[model samples]
Target: MLISDSQKKILSLLADGEFHSGAELAEVLGVSRSAVWKQLNGLESLGVPHAAVSGKGYRLSRPIELLDGAKILDHLDEQHRAKISSLEIHDQIDSTNTYLSSLARQNAPSGSVCLAERQTAGKGRRGRQWISPYGSNILLSILWRFQHGPAAISALSLAIGVAVIRALRRLGIDKAGLKWPNDIYSEGKKLGGILIEVAGENEGPCYAVTGLGLNLFLPEEEAGAIDQPWTDLGRIAGGRPIGRNQLAGELIDQLLKVLTGFEQTGLAAYLDEWREYDCLCGESASVFIGAQQFDGTLEGIDAQGFLLMRDADDRLRAFASGEVSFRRAFP
Candidate 1:
């Protein structure tokens, strides 16, 4: 899934959703018409859609707001920009999380961010394959080094969820909510998810790679692969497109704020804020653990970020992690 420099150049030219004649593209890219044709033929593998008309030349089905590292940095405020150690953008990668995880092994500094336009092997929580089309959505990961161990950051993902909701709100998407441990929802449909991977000691220094996958504009082919109901930010925003650079800047800013706050005050500082967007706060939830199952009424999350539920026997139960689903119980 490697996108050559020539292909990237051609994509940038076609990104406006307007037709470009083969001769015109060839001249602009300083390549032969055959070379441009070859690159155009390879766009399908990258999940980019285009139309080739006899007289009108080639036109993309939709215009894309591609990521620009410079624009992202420019959008950040001085304080937030100072916190970021490094930010890298890729045309294609296996996974942003995987890339940052490897860097963490080399003592990668905190506040490093990685973004990818296309992920051939993108991953989600619980071993689900993340569907990412080139120039279609947000696929990013941030690396952070913590003085405390992995156990101390148990509430990290929950805090990250809050950051995501806040970032969406900044873009006028105020209806987004958090679904328990790690998913973002809009109008009861899945919008995005968070995946955190930690490496290092249990009681000392640790590194975490926090990954986020958000749907922006999913085509029919990609949407068909998802097993659950899903919604994209574009549709929720009345089909108005938001630039990827602006969205990325907002996410990094909010994420850094929450991470710094968590580093200082633990999860207690975010409990009340998280409750405001808690999607399953009062819904009946069922958890499946191997051959066992437990059903209870959601009482919101505890201060430690664990899910709190009132069981059938009137006892409160807290779960660290499991496969959970919400259901309505008949009165």
Candidate 2:
């Protein structure tokens, strides 16, 4: 069974460095002492550490450092506060996007966030496997129901990329950049990727699930499994492992802020910001489009979110979504 509301309340009360006697807590919460004890036991079963002092009643061994949904909600500006309906955290899951999609199918409210500490079967664009080890990365998804058609949702991933870069910059890593479509990078190594999945018609109301997978403290062994060059926040932050909970909160905050604007303006409004941080701009690169590949100088993305590249013939072409890959040119 899931933890009860009273148990969650007890956990919240003990989140800080305060202790409450059984009688005191019961009186404050309008419950019986026995009820409080039962809830405490439930928390223990859920792996939350606590000390039962004879006189002091209960005290957490360490402050609970999980992301506080209430705190995040309180921090949001008035415009975004109304859209958020719920924030759910899980210790482990197959995929946050998949989990949230189930709720979306049931008509779950927009701005619902689903986060997991670990994802055993995380996925990326084109069904690529997303590496998600336990307690080492942030795996989360946000549900945004849109009134726009599916065509307008093409730039959703780009918008999310902008949000991620902004959030990382706010966390003091100002060098973060965006790779077209979805990847985030710093100094050429990948920091994260975004995957946007739509669950509606092309011309009807659509539900977009924006998923993010960010590396925080990737294990050496786990990192080796990645075929491409990758990086984590620990290295970028000067060897300090960033707090996952703190990063998660910042990510949600930035995503919510950007998403609110995206709902109104589509992707055209964020083109300038996205271009400013695009790492591939002015670099010679190649993009694979199915059986053919185009090698050219990376110009930048247009207002419509298509990649603008100047081919060898000095002709510019716009490339839409596909199995496109990026590589640096050697002199």
> Best lDDT goes to which candidate?
1
Residue by residue across 4-54, what tens digits does model 2's lDDT show? Answer: 668667766876747878998898789999988877876654446578889
TM-score of each: 0.96, 0.77
Residue 252 Cα positional deviation in candidate 1, in Å, after optimal superposition: 0.6
- Per-candidate RMSD, Å: 2.0, 6.9
lDDT of 1 by residue, 9-103 (tens): 88899999999999999999999989888898899888897899998899888998789998988767789889899999999999999999999
Task: Give stretches of model 2 more than 4 Å off.
Answer: 1-79, 329-331
| TM-score of candidate 1 versus the correct structure, residues matched by position | 0.96
Candidate 1: misplaced stretches above 4 Å? Answer: 328-331
lDDT by candidate, in order shown = 0.88, 0.79
Worst 10 residues of 1 by lDDT: 322-331
